[model samples]
Target chain A: MSKVRFGVIVFPGSNCDRDCYYVLKDLLQVKVDYIWHQEEKPKGFDCLILPGGFSYGDYLRCGAIARFSPVMEFVQDFAEQGGLVLGICNGFQILLECGLLPGAMLRNQGLKFVCQFIYVRVDNNQIPFTGAAQPGQVLQLPVKHNEGNYYVEEETLKEMKRRGQIVLRYSTKEGVVTREANPNGALDNIAGICNERKNVFGLMPHPENSSEPILGSQDGLLIFKSMLQYMEDGEFRYGGGEEFRYEEGREDDLDA
Target chain B: MKRVLVYVTPKKGILDPAGQATQRALQSLGYHEVEEVKIGKYIQLTIQDNNFSESSIKEMCSRLLANPVIEDYHYEVSDV
Candidate 1:
């Protein structure tokens, strides 16, 4: 293909479709198209994005209803075949609902909808999503959600840690991961994660919302740029061995 | 016709913020004996009697109505 094509599947209530489309099309200047939720399976696209918003009015759960959309069946097949897929905010919720990524989101521990720019430390920059970022670099990203509190059973969490599927965590500007820095109290401050194959990634942060300086931060654009780079030049899938900074409170930490 | 009632709730040991908030609200309202309040979803589905199967209902609950990762679900079927 001359240019890498991207498809942003728009669920019925997805409000951030334009934001993602704008970044991939206008800012990144790539071949991008929109796939309505009811549309047929997508083909010929290098990557697919599930943008942020209250799909199906977030009925039953943040992503429960949206997961069953016709396009998602194709998305599941796409991710299984190692095609790159990224989900943002509510999109991330849908990914979880569909078992694209392991874990579930609970209401913010504080019981409020939090909307703010928070710093996130890139835990594993080897993944395509963070290839352009420096190792352990703290990126200022915006997260707006009520149910961004990520939760996974303990045993699976250990396996995720061992495999480095965790790719980002809420953190201080100095790249320090701390409990106080966590906005929604996501378990171990997880903000972003990828699957074991590293082909599917999901994060509660809204990268599109912060993709430009005019939006108050251009830090989020790095994610899009890196993904584009991967489409063109990436030949290997990365599995990481970096130490997670938020390991302080895990079961193993107490033993140590 | 048939009716299915699915009840979904956060699994034990998982934090339930909305439920906790409700508990606090009740306490503030002088319902101190209401030691705990946990919120969950109740979904009622109307189905064709012949199309309703126990396995299918369970599948729907496990796949869509409840996320087994952090929530639990149970459903009852009744004639309508």
Candidate 2:
């Protein structure tokens, strides 16, 4: 199998960019590059990862300002072309701001920054990012954010649930989904979700921070391994090969 | 110069943990009359253009001043 190239977007104040780059390039042994936010054009890569950090110092909201960066235009186009995009932590907020993902993030319900390891259950294993795990499998990942509480309208939540777009949920170590297990008080204990096309995914946890056993937990490595496996199996093409029908009414109509 | 005063707040149905926490803190300080507290952002933009119109300001608010999904914004324009 050819090397799966990955691109890690680096925005101003993105502290996790190096972590993601290190995991993908060194740990995962993949071809990875860093794409700065100021770059108007994105380099050709199989997958793009938006690493976490206080982009723009969390000005005017977590990702409101960073979403307008020049490179986001290319990222939007890339996702529209069915390119795989994964957003972690503040990156998740950017995805929400850019309309690449549904829902919004609010201040954590506890009114404080949460920085600790939490368990999340794999809600859907069929997606390209979670194919390495089984449904209901529990993975321990670290989350460090003050505004990680996810919110969505009731109707949209139902539609996402129906479409299996809810990819991960905060859960207990035993894989039991319970309210008490939710660290950030996200709606329905949702820790992560993907777009209708399932090509874009956003989650608040820092998967890269836990990708190595030296970090005390390598469970998060499964996500990166799953992406490589998907690419190796010829499930995704780096450049556009087959034109996919862009689903209508799936652009996260927030007004509803 | 024209002064644009923008106020951005979370939507009504959305949870505001900061506001809630502040409200609780206030209540603990003996301000029991506080019915509700919603925290938000106040931004002031000074525009040098005399031709600034309400539509243009509204466009600015919609585009950058606020996020329609989670926030709503209103603005007041005055000559300065």
Interface RMSD of each: 0.8, 1.0
lDDT of 1 by residue, B20-72 (tens): 88999999999999977878989999999778788988998887788899889
On residues A40-71, what C-alpha lDDT tens digit does candidate 2 reach at each position?
Answer: 98767999999999999998889989999999
Against the true structure, what is model 1's DockQ? 0.87
| DockQ score for model 2 | 0.81
Model 2 segments beyond 4 Å from truth?
A236-256
- List fnat per candidate, in order: 1.00, 0.82
> What's the fnat for candidate 1, on a 0 to 1 scale?
1.00
TM-score of chain A of each: 0.92, 0.91
Steric clash pairs (candidate 1): none
Candidate 1 per-residue lDDT over residues A92-209, each given as its tens digit: 9999999989999999999889999999988888888888777788899999999999999999988888777889899889987888789998998899999998889999998999
